[model samples]
Target: MRRCPGGRSWRRAAWRLRCFRFVKIDCYSIETNIQIFAVCASVARRCGYPNRPDRGGGPMNFSARGLSAMFSVLRQRNFAIYTSGSTVSLIGTWMQRVTVGWLCWELTGSGAWLGLLAFADMFPSVIVGPLAGAAADRWDRLRIARISQMLGLLQATFLFVALVAGFLTIELLFAVVLFHGVVEAFNQPSRLALIHSLVGRERLGAAVAINSIAFNLARFVGPAIAGVLIATVGVAWAFALNAMTFGAFALALAAVSLVRDDALAPRSGFLREIVDGFAYSVRHPGIGPILMLMIAAGVGGRAVVELLPGFAADVFGAGPIGLAALTSSVAVGAILGGFVVGVRQSYTGLTRTVIVSVFGIALAVAAFTVTDTLYLGAAALAVAGFFMVTTGVGSQTLVQLAVDGSMRGRVLSLHGLIFRGGPALGALLMGVSSEFAGLRLPVAVGAAILAICAFFALTRVNAIADALENEPRN
Candidate 1:
């Protein structure tokens, strides 16, 4: 009995030793696997996929897949709401735009005043965008957006009332548009900066593309609807519908449940922030070039939008429907361009894409200037649309990708300034040229300028591409 007990004790001890070794080996394997994963994940995250989750315990639970999934969710909800609201609102906005242009033409019959109104409406964006961006960084963007929407609704209502009462003159129209533009100066930056909060940085490019899709989709629908509405209902109903449409967006804004970060720096003096923001933008290599490109494009390329009214009336002689078709063609191309960028995983080749697209835009603009046929004009506009969206979306993606979290709002404000201000300057110059020279002169001149800018961009493509390459990965 003693021998049996001793043998059993020895067997138990040996079994326990083997089990201990096995457990240690298993634990080591798991640890090794996790370390390997972290290294692989870190690499991917640095390559613009910042959402990868680490092993064990960590606060930042990021994964490329997870980021993509989150974007899918946000896209479904935000895109649906924004797209629907914008579709309705943009139709009304476009109608008002066409009517305003027509009214201006009827009242003064000069492209200069038309350009003046356009400049008046858009110029505030340049002046007010930085302040607004500071506010967006400091305040609750959602609330700011809501308030701006309400203000816009009120502005639209006043315009509608004026039109209905027969008190709508060109001056009143210009004043109302200017008021609306001021509101937009605040609204656009907040709305754009707010997008990062909704979807996070990982999917920002996709979010931007989706947003462009919404705007362009509206572009597609708005002009066609505006054309029909103006032909059928007269211009007063168009203004009223614009008011109602803004009201719907306000309601939608009220309904969305956004998750915002509270990490933003406290609000400071407006001028200080604006100056600081501008200084930072000038210093940053990546953002500086992008802003410069936007300025060039806006001034030289995007002014085409301002001339569409004249093109439809003077060049095509097809009236409102023709104008609508021209606008929609551009939108259609833009929508396609947005889709192309939205699907790409990185902005690696964006510099080349932008340069090519800019050249394309120049070619299209030159082509459109010579063409008198509506179909040919539409075709040119469509090509122009494609190039425009590619340039815009590509620049946005590059800027967003290059910026850090702290400076996003400020940098984007500069972006807003270029986007809004560039066109204003362009329109003013073009309008003046058209008045002094002819419509063809502005178009031809703008195209040549765009071509030169594109060439400049191409020459620096290597530097831009290097900057993108050198960006710190997540």
Candidate 2:
């Protein structure tokens, strides 16, 4: 076999993979072949699979190696268990979300009610996130996550019961959604901080990326499952299914053990700690700036995603199919982007990647605004989604790696608050603006805002990298 530029090691792996698969290697582009080879080799080393010289060893399994690398963080036994349960729970969560939205529309037949429902689901983070963060730091993170998930299961069960018993109303539905929103507000920070204990600092980035991949995967799968259930059995079954998943996750949480727990010393007042988390994040050179960048993209660039339905109806004239196409495109891009970032072994160039992704998202959205064709618009939105996940996951991974252990929950809560709430605020503003100025221009202006923020971030990349990457662990 002729040697490739990547050297003999990867080539040998590729040759072995090619022989095992029994397909023509030339069917895939050389570049694609190289990537497959690289991922196979890297996963082999990481997962303790054999990739030594072409001795009389057995044939290599490229697919197994690729999957191992994609889920490399699962090597942490606790995380693997946690992830197994959470994956089931997340799919159910999405099912419930879709069912609830459909039920709301059926009852009210008002777009205004749908907007209000979305606001209720998202706005609690603004009020509850800081306090929740403080609680995560003060109490046991695993305990908090388990309790919140249990509450989620109960919420789903109640919704199902109410719907079956003929006592459900719009007011009750609204109230229940708001209650669950508060539960999730508490859940987000604790669950995120808990990953550190389960996986340790070395695998934190991979864990975060894997979490995102699972989320996007469920985003696609859940709606399809919900649609089938809602159409055939009943809308109530979606909630029932969600309740089961939540129970599974809660049980899984009970089964896992933490590898490294952050000792929560008795701190000052709870309110003081919340304030201190904010103060520390604001004062830190690296976190402070990247956070500001995230907010800009969240409000401006990310907000556009929430308005895609309007774009489909008004700009593309494709209706539900157009909306589904655009939505699926985004999900595909996000999953692919998460997979790409998940394989990294270091944070060496991640800061720059984060900054560049901000620009990529902005430009992609800007391109989307100008396109009148549905296919082109979907393509552009896919690019936006790719950059959107990269920016989110990248910023989050950096924050997780840089934050002091004591402040992990509090700082991450701030990150979670902006991640969940910023786009809601932006969507409200941009949605209203679209009513007066039209949809395209408001989205275009939001992209412009994001581009400007990226330009500012470009100037500070080196400083942010040094502060985030070089900081000593607590």
The candidate scoring highest on lDDT is 2
Per-residue C-alpha lDDT of model 1 across residues 1-474, encoded as one tens digit per residue = 001123578886875675465445334433443343343334223423222222101122234663464348355575457546656666666666766776677678787887888887788988888888788777788888889878878987887788777787888888888998888888877777777776666777778887787777777676655654555456666667778888888887777666654267555687787787788878877668767877888888788787788888888886666667777777766776666556565556666676767777888788888989876777777767767887787777777667666566777888887887888888888888898887778877888988998888778877876675458432
Output the TM-score of candidate 1. 0.82
Candidate 2, after superposition: displacement of residue 135 in Å? 0.7
lDDT by residue (tens digit), candidate 2, 154-272: 99999999998889999999899889989998889988888788878877877899998888777656755765565446788889999999999999999987878777836899889
Error of 1 at 409 (Å): 1.7
The top-ranked prediction according to TM-score is 1
How high a TM-score does candidate 2 get?
A: 0.81
Q: Write down the RMSD of all candidates, one decimal each.
A: 23.4, 13.3
* Count of clashing residue pairs in every prediction: 7, 0
Runs in model 2 deviating more than 4 A are 1-70, 104-112, 164-171, 231-234, 309-324, 371-373
Runs off by more than 4 Å, candidate 1: 1-83, 266-268, 472-474
